[model samples]
Target chain A: MGSTATAKIVALPMVDKHADPEPVETKASAAQMSAAEIQVPEPEPIPTVSLTKVFLGLLGYVTRERMITALLACISIGALFLFWYLGTKYRLEFYIRFKNVPTPYEVYQQLTQVGLSNKYLFNIAMSVRRILLGFMIATIIGVPLGLAIGKYERVRDFFMPVVEIMRPIPAIAWVPMSIMLWPNNEASIVFITFIGAFFPILLNTIHGVHSLDGVLVRAARCLGASEIRLFMNVILPGSLPHIFTGLAVGMGVAWVSLIAAEMISGQFGVGYFTWEAYSLVDYPAIVLGMITIGVLGLACSGIIRMVGVLLMPWLAFAPGGRR
Target chain B: MSMTMTEAETHKGFIDVRDMGVTFGANDNKVVAVDNVSLNVQPGEFVSLIGPSGCGKSTLLSIVAGFVKPTRGEALLDGKAITKPGSDRGVVFQQYSLFPWLSVRKNVEFGLKMAGVEQSKRNTTARALLDLAGLLSFENHYPDQLSGGMKQRIGIVRALATSPQVLLMDEPFGALDTQTRVVMQEILTNIWQQFRISVLFITHDIEESIFLSDRIYVMTARPGRIKAVIKVPLPRPRTAEMTDTPEFMNLVQELKGLIREESLAAMAPEIKDRGLSGFGMKVGPKGVGEIF
Candidate 1:
């Protein structure tokens, strides 16, 4: 057997690299008689590293990562500060026309006042409760439907057309229908919120379930997992990242639609407070409402993110952490 | 010595697959993956199915594992026809089939839990398997935290956790680097010897089959059929040194010849035609005749 010729090139001598200018038979046939004698040169020794070198290398990596984050944060904060100072200093027409452009300090005061007022907290709590209720209901309906649609072609075919037709219509558009369909005004608002959040959650869940590795399912089957066990053990856990994705998206949609729903429903909520302030042209209160919505949206999304981190800590360190 | 031909003969196969054919789609749209393939794996025997990528080796393994049913013919375990997947057979996939969400211990425990092995026994079984795979310390770590070899080891442990009668492996170490793959082969050989589990391993690598299998079944492509089944007369408890022997080399060469022909056959039609799609061979005159 011509082993040398067929063998992959494994090595070269160090001095041979610098000095040699020779041709040799490296063919497998030439080495057949003494296959054991055929040898590849040893690889160069790795450079030794001291403890200081190792420690410094790790330090450099950490510092570089943190520095980039710090730089981006500084730039964004600086930009925001500049915009606030300039908008108030020159009194921009947009800010002036609304007369609701509270200075940074005034906005802070309003934030504190909203935080302190029991009634304010109550309204905020009510809005959050409504959002939660609607979100919870949508999740219950949407996740199972999404999973079914994802798993079964027949189920998908039956439900997809109806879902597609309903998916595009704005959640606000459902307000009147919901009011008519349900007896209570609160139910109508909740329905609108559900409509707002349902599609993204359902769509993402379907995608997640559909995108699961078929081999994993096969693995589960061979392991003697019953149908329900397979879903719980393999399918559900596999699609969880997508479910979290849907929840985050659904939460965002819920916030956007909840404010709109409250505004339209003429309810005792933050949206109503904002509308009332607008009717009276109370500028600070309007500023308060916008900031409240912004902060609340941030807090809700943050909560969703925190939940995601807690559930799938491994995912946070995955190739690229999107959140 | 107790070793005798009659003993070998009396060692009845654990699974019998006779003239099994798996064809996808229907009638005019039909495509055959495995065609009239018959195989028998005896108790504690290590058998490998080797061929080109499209030679239905995987399909055949899947049929044995009960992941897919043969369109025609029967696959039986201990004389009874197999229909659906069961805990009796465990499969390790090529793609390090460890569940990313679960820790190493948990992944192994999955099959045990399915078998309804109580929590106490499950932990013990999981730990033993993990220890056998040399991954006892990584029990608490998720699949992502492990290297390719470690993940594959976990996969093996997971498959064996149910204490299945047969272990079906589909190129389980195909994704690992060359060095890691060699190490894993050794690890697998050790595990197989320890468990004495009947195995139906599949691979495209010629040398891999020679290194690990007791007998190898070479397959033809497309509407795949078994071309040859050659018994490897190498002595058992094979070591790394055994792979360098003249006998092993000769076996590797023989297997390569079979695989090389199928590989060329598998691609012959594709190279012959400029426009080709799945299973649809466009007959054209720019054809290169059989390489063999």
Candidate 2:
């Protein structure tokens, strides 16, 4: 058995020599056979669908689901209007005290009139501008500060106590202090709005930077990444998903605070419009202002979400992100 | 094993670890990870360090890669002491460390990008390496989009991108299934043959060590020290068929015997605490059964 084993070991080189050509010969013959088969006539390619056909297909695809949802929404609105109309017209127990509550028809008339009025447009535009400016200011400061705190333990230790103390105070509570702090009413209102949006952005960004995978950092270091390169390439991009989440939440809070700030201080905004309508006992106009705020908030949040999806195509294409 | 050598003379070995040791913690809590381990890898030679779990094989490799400092002696590459991780010595971890945010091609080109290679050159090098691993089509795919085997292949190609002199692989195929493991081993052998780079591989598999290495270093259990150095006398351009040959089986049996003996020795303390009857018996389907 020992001799046989020795003989096989000695013949291993001969086996390797023979093995090389055997695979090449088989591969060459297989390639030739495949090439010969490729000479046969091919089947006709499937015709491309027309653009109009694709559009119509998409329209059909969306309209079915959307139509059902739209119908359901219309029914819900109709039911709510019917209840309000019956309660207000017949002077029901709850409606007896709610004499200021306008009928659905009156509210609709006010809505159409408000749509044509320049005052309504001015309030919306002013509110949007103030919210945008406040949110931008908050984001610019919050992102960098959060990143620093997350990346450096010394920075975190120094700033964390101050942030923790200030974060939980409501934006409405800031109204008195901001008014005294800022030189003008506009600045104070923006300050309150900034306060509202800042914490969410800061906290989420810190979380994002803190939760970065250690393995990725090590891998980048081994690959010769400098400190700045590591931060820019690994930390920044890795924290993006959380940053986007913060932005969306911040956007919602910005609108809330903008309206609150406008209501408390001298302002021509959606919040002031609602407050003025209430003092004038214009019930239909009050409902109109509420609707306008709702629509504006929805649009702002939607835009933020769209931008987030645009920035992170990878996340958009990930398994759970399927539309 | 030669003790006396002048620092001025050029070393023949690409990586030389001399009496290296690592001790974690301090005073009463001190734990020796590696103890007086010395080894060398000649230029273009493939060497493996195999041992039971917690044998400090990984720590030894880490010291060579410059990620960890040895408390005693030192690890040298090209006769220079390694103090920190550098692109010259590439490491492939058991966990697929490919960045999930980057595409496969970009991950492969990461080291080159860090070295400030021009974009076009990076693209060409990345494409070539991807094509070599038969993953050119997967260049645009993210790490998570690929299978475990494909991710590891990308990891290997990523390490090779900078053209490192020595490749440090720590159980690169340990996470793979058996079939993928075999295929990966073959791919690795092919790449190593072409690159001809010195490699210091750490693994727990005896068969893998024998199959891949020119010399296998078996290490003792924790407080790990080199127990044996066995040479694999197989012919070059090793084929899978060689694994089934009589010579291969004999070498495998011999190595298994050595490993089993060491394993038993490592288990001796536990056996003494539990008693031989409790140590040998294990819960089986029918009832307690003899495990040894």
Candidate 3:
């Protein structure tokens, strides 16, 4: 048991890329050094926590507890596959139709055939680029505007109404107006994507600022922080965790907007490919395009999560991290 | 006002509140949190405000800290009106108010950094202060990683890093367990003795007030007014053994009596309004057994 524990400690996972290495090493040595001094008749080796590696962390910082969570995630996805296989094989048509839908193997066949094609690859690249560009622009404009709206009462009064009135309107509803407003299809689609991502980021940021602890501001002021210094030191850091939440939610919305714009007016994008396949009666191809979209959407959100982890190093090993 | 007090002779942390009152809302909804009250803290003196829960002890402290404006009069620090919060007065709150994002060392260094101190200087100052608090080893840890007592200790150390003239504390140990609170009281007195900075503390604990303060101000409940001003005659570098002495116990009984009177008065209006002032009324299904 002792040897296994030592090996486990030796293979400890990293919490963050910038996690300080000194404590982890010292704790490890301390635990090992204490082994020879005590000979109590305990059933198991008493846990000596190496704080850096033993607790939960983000991305590549997988501990044994997180591994079980990962395993459960895999099982959930596997269940979905099992349902899909059964549905296609039995031609189930309980409420929704799956009578003529292709099996998972058939979809895989379609993926191998056209997935490597220039058109498919090109469409995937276009959709990803559009979403990323739109998201970057949205974040740049939304975060500061949100911060301003959150900080000053007058700014909130002016902007919050416009945001509130426009927020509930679907991005797809703006597609026609966006097309007329911009010079080209790319600009129009990007605009629609921006509209999709912007409001959540703005609203979340406002809420974040509004919810900031008043006592913290008092504490900061009493500590001699000037107005600018208070904003930089307290206000900015306090709202960052919320901003990232906004970013992740924005990324998801941006994808939905991207697909709508691409399906309606795009020359090339995964959304266009999926819609075109439907028009051409290529069932398997449509499924394959959808799968591509799902994979890419997951990838986009995963990247946002990792960035959130990177920015909030304090939250890296915390269980809930942030709300 | 004394004629002989020179500008240099008047040291830092000399607080003066003259007829200060703070009222919230107005007209029909008007609530007077603090009434016309006057008090002063001598430079380097340890003072405490003790009262019932709603007696505006915290409001008085907040006025001194420059967080709340006085509706009637003024609060002065070292002979100047406190127009706004400044580094000259540091505050420690009851909530253990350290930024969770910062490491313990960084939390301590926050005030110094705000004052434009260099990184190396911040480090050394923070380290020295953390050592003084007996938390030098835990400097690298975050606030969330520390226990309640540790967080409050860091809060004290952080407040002192700027070399502030006065420390304004509002029941800082109110949330801690009894054991931790006693230990913290000792730790705080030690820090106070070391720096000799003036402290204006607020607490509901009578013993805490008597134990820590050179002078104690007892206040009445809502629209709070100063009820009494008492001096603690305990010698310097006070020990736990001092608490058991007849003098200390006598002070405790005195403070408790003062506070109990105000607490009963605080409840009287509400009881009258609710029409539950008399014991003749039936309560809880008309039987004591049913209530129990």
Q: Which stretches in model 3 have alpha-carbon errors above 4 Å?
A: A1-64, A90-95, A316-323, B1-10, B273-292
Tens digits of lDDT, candidate 2, B1-292: 0111233322233999999889999999999999999999988889999888887999998888878889999899989999988888888999898887788999999999999999999998897777666566568978776667678878987988887788899999999777557556656775676677889999888778878889999898888999999999988666566789898888888888877877877787888766555556545655545555
Q: Give model 2's docking category.
A: acceptable
Best by TM-score: 3
> Can you write out model 1's per-residue Cα lDDT over A1-323, one digit (the tens) per residue?
13332232222122122221111211111122123223232222222455368669978988998999999999998898678767866677852442346677666677687657887777787788888899999999999889889998999999999999999898888878888899998888889889988999999999999899898898889889998898888888888899989999999999889888888884777787788778887666777887788888889889988988888866743446542
Docking class of 3: incorrect
Error of 1 at B7 (Å): 14
Fraction of real interface contacts that model 2 preserves: 0.25
**Worst lDDT 10-window in candidate 2 chain A:** A28-37
Clashes of 2: 0
Candidate 3 backbone clash number: 0
Highest lDDT model number? 3
Which residue pairs in candidate 2 have backbone atoms (N, alpha carbon, C) closer than 3 angstroms, thus clashing? none
Model 1 C-alpha RMSD vs. true structure (Å) is 9.0
Candidate 2 lDDT over A61-81, as tens digits, reads 779989998999999988977
Candidate 2 all-Cα RMSD: 8.8
DockQ of 1: 0.20
